[model samples]
Target: MNMNVAERQGDCHSQLLSSHNARDLLNSVDAFLFDCDGVIWKGDTLIDGVSQTLDMLRSKGKKLVFVTNNSTKSRRQYAKKFQSLGISVSEDEIFCSSFAAAMFLKVNNFPREKKVYVIGEEGILEELQLAGFTGLGGPEDGKKTVQLKPNCLFEHDKTVGAVVVGLDQYINYYKLQYGTLCIRENLGCLFIATNQDAVGHMTDLQEWPGAGCMVAAICGSTQKEPIVVGKPSTFLMDFLQQKFQISCSKMCMVGDRLDTDVLFGKNAGCKTLLVFSGVTSHSTLHDPSNSIEPDYCTNKLSDILELLGP
Candidate 1:
């Protein structure tokens, strides 16, 4: 633990969830919320002892809920990945930005006549389709491009009323051109993004541009910000509370990012545990400029087992 963090929240901040008061903290929370990409696994590899820690927690009758800002995979797909990784998670145990995006449109009473122009992946498209929304401009278009010649014209679907952006690995100038035109040309057009994370760690040492990068491009051109539905929004937290009938006070959010995960937990009135296995480093947390802080901090997910006992 850093001296600065200790001073801000004191040495007894949430009891540190250490061996001294781990039992009390564990007993207090009925459920544990997790952020997937950083906390559990890094890319296709599972972090050491993550499965064991989760299993141990589950054995104690604690409910596990995964809240992720990743809009690339739908809940079903996420479940499949969990099975492959030996995590034993169900579809209901997962909530993602893709599902949140679909729910947002549904709750807003989006017209059936209007379709969504997707700047994302198959997961987002599947969610939209399941939500009874027709989506356009996905990987189905392949690498198609339109020439901006003097006498050339670009054709767009007139019925696309909402432009939904997510983590699209196949992002291109053509997609950006079309997405920009849709928001600029259409009246009452809705622009939305799954998250605004600038960069996502592809691996322990490699980083890739996230959805926010592409969303920023569109925003720059259209001068319109999107209605984000991912972490730190509190919409998903509200959705989970309503869906699972769980109280915010009885939950703890564990993640590796301070801005999204810690801030989300803070906004939702839940205890937050920060792990130093991903984006944030100890020095980063120690920085005075950093505003977001978690109730407890540890080296990794497995460290929680110290409180669980042998």
Candidate 2:
């Protein structure tokens, strides 16, 4: 019964002609954009065939780029991790949301040389500092502007260039309230967030809150929509095109999530390929009418190689 149901539901890929067609089309693809975390590897372990398939794609002369929302590490660190995984990737090939955020602020004229109050994690804070945004109320000056607690608000610093939000494992009420106030006081205060992945890596579905969660809370309090520059934001795409001279027409975003990965490609005017090896598993690939569909779907990256046509 399960076999029959699975076949009936997912036979789109099983169809011999459709499978051949997708492979042929994918072979013609030039630039391949990948999403990390769920798409390439779930948590720490490498997803099977990932390394080999990427190598294969590279051998086929297709340009590769790994675009991720995970800002916990820099591009250099991510490249090292991929190298450690036997997947050869250069630092220039990786694009993280944190990097994009910093670049976005820099490009958008985010008030250079300002002491900014941050309500995010180390990754974000590091990028802000690199971009010249100083930390306010941090322990450096032995200052304590706001106490950590639920529904707490920190005193505002006049020099906040923007209220940037990312994955905060140690978030509290004070951070949320103060961050929102920064946006509310001036709707033009420049709001930014990482990504909107609600749940991640766990059983019993103990989904952790995403940056979008904080953005939502702040938006609820401030009536301001964040300048989302993550997946589907086109900021990264813009960065890529400007850096590499790759046309948007020849780019393809190959990821595993429908909401983020696929939507990113669709919004950025790139082809979207949904691989079942990551976040949105086979079961979640149902209800086609539910919105957020990819241009092509495959069970594995290796399967994409065959699409290169005979």
Candidate 3:
């Protein structure tokens, strides 16, 4: 018997995975959607037993798709990171929010003549270029300072059709001004956000402000909410579904973020497994105020291997 979302959440909210159920879950899913930062690694350091667990899953013929909300890197950059961590992953197996932002524009038939104004990093620019769109005002405007004079005219590119915001390490007033001008001044200009994660593991030592901060700056100036293309939106999920010819029921989303990762899985009708190796904590998961819950909870991704035995 199949259960509704509410019923399923109520029945197995944060249910710890054991050998019996681990084997059952393993056999039930044909694909796994993983959030990179928390589930597979934290910052630059790969999680212990991750490569082995991924190998085990691959050995079972489960399709692996690394879906990340981090927009700081392109698919190629992510592939390099995977290689550095000693995990074999192809660029095709990675789906990042930066790539999703570019895909959203392409799939929507955005005019090729108009360019995109970026308020993020090179990742956004790279993806936009790969999608055959020109991107302006990323790190190029990082050192630019706008001097406000009495009659000074603040001019921006009129050909910009969209403003894409992501995790920008070099965020500055100049980029924000350019992006805001494009969104607010340009007619019918689209405001697109990669993700709205509040915080992320920017470095191995600690968390840092995420793309939401950059998006919020633009939102504050333009007074327009952006169309999010990342997790919890199902935009990427739809793309993945069509590309892989897989149903949501046959995939499991593994991550450490409840708001983005787990909620994304639930929204997409996929099974969710939350690991406590990143942003989320045990108390936070069980908090009464927390409505979103994963179908299963484990200490880490490798716990599946331990639970399943040899």
Candidate 4:
């Protein structure tokens, strides 16, 4: 799954544009949604010229929003990171997986008396709180342990109506045991995940187990799949559309990954752009097994600047 761009060489869609034709592609959309990490930054470092490219897009009167599947940070925290990188993004312009999970529950009319049992981190908890939902069972008691056996009942929280999973650095038998119990024992306990990305991007150029790894453990234990709220799911797009009243025809999704970012754009009826500065490689795009394709492909996000007329 981790093919290098050079190794995965193949023809992309016919929509591929050069510097000359790039301007026309840019003219086709009024709004732009970007993925963080691979697309904008690599860990704590911002991608070269990313700030200028975003500024250029904003100056062109294009609406911009940062969409990330990483549930480790809240919108406020994400905004702080943008500011730290000299990119002026407001919290309102950010939509992360944590927010999407919270919104999904809210729209479903999740019970006010019921609380969500979280297996993630503070970001998820904060987002749930911001959406007026109660979350428990995260780092507050991550160290708490309980021995559970097969088909054995343990005293559990009766108010837990949902089991939401994302990335948890402290994920242990305790969290997994409780999460499985909530899904197996509790009636109508909704299962949700931020993303299914197996390998997360890191600055060290090493692959780390993503949120999907944790979600997989729970799935294996409970024999249930979670409703993912991140990329490739139109839930976030639907939320953005309803909240911003923006038309998909005027929107474009730009990112480095294909399965999530490109598929997400395709699902939401937005133009998709794939940049090689991240996880996806040209060969991976060419892989016949890969069904997702972007409207355009470039070496890096900065390549799109060529579309910006002088």
Using lDDT as the measure, which candidate wins? 3
Could you give candidate 2's per-residue lDDT for residues 197-261 as a string of tens digits?
66554222234666666667777787777778788777888889887887776888888778888
Task: Compare candidates 3 and 4 on TM-score and give the better one.
Answer: 3
Name model 4 segments beyond 4 Å from true. Answer: 1-11, 147-153, 307-309
* TM-score: model 3 vs. ground truth: 0.95
Worst 10 residues of 3 by lDDT: 3-12
Please provide, for model 1 over 1-310, each residue's C-alpha lDDT reduced to its tens digit, 9 standing for 90 to 100.
Answer: 5466547534333334577556767888999999998789988789999999999999999999999888888899999999999989998899999999998999999998998998988888988998899989888654887787898888788888999998888988788888988999988899999988887775656668888887898899999999999988898987888878889989999998888999999999998889888888876776666778788888899988966679
TM-score of 1: 0.94
Residue-by-residue lDDT tens digits, candidate 4, 35-122: 9988899888888878878888888898899899999889999999899988889998999999999999999999988999999988
TM for every model, in the order presented, reads 0.94, 0.82, 0.95, 0.92
Show where candidate 1 strays beyond 4 Å.
1-17
Collision count for each candidate, in order: 0, 5, 0, 4
Clashes of 4: 4
lDDT of each: 0.86, 0.70, 0.92, 0.86
Candidate 3 off by > 4 Å: 1-12
- The candidate, 1 or 4, that scores higher on TM-score is 1
Cα shift from native, residue 39, model 2 (Å): 1.4
Model 4 TM-score is 0.92
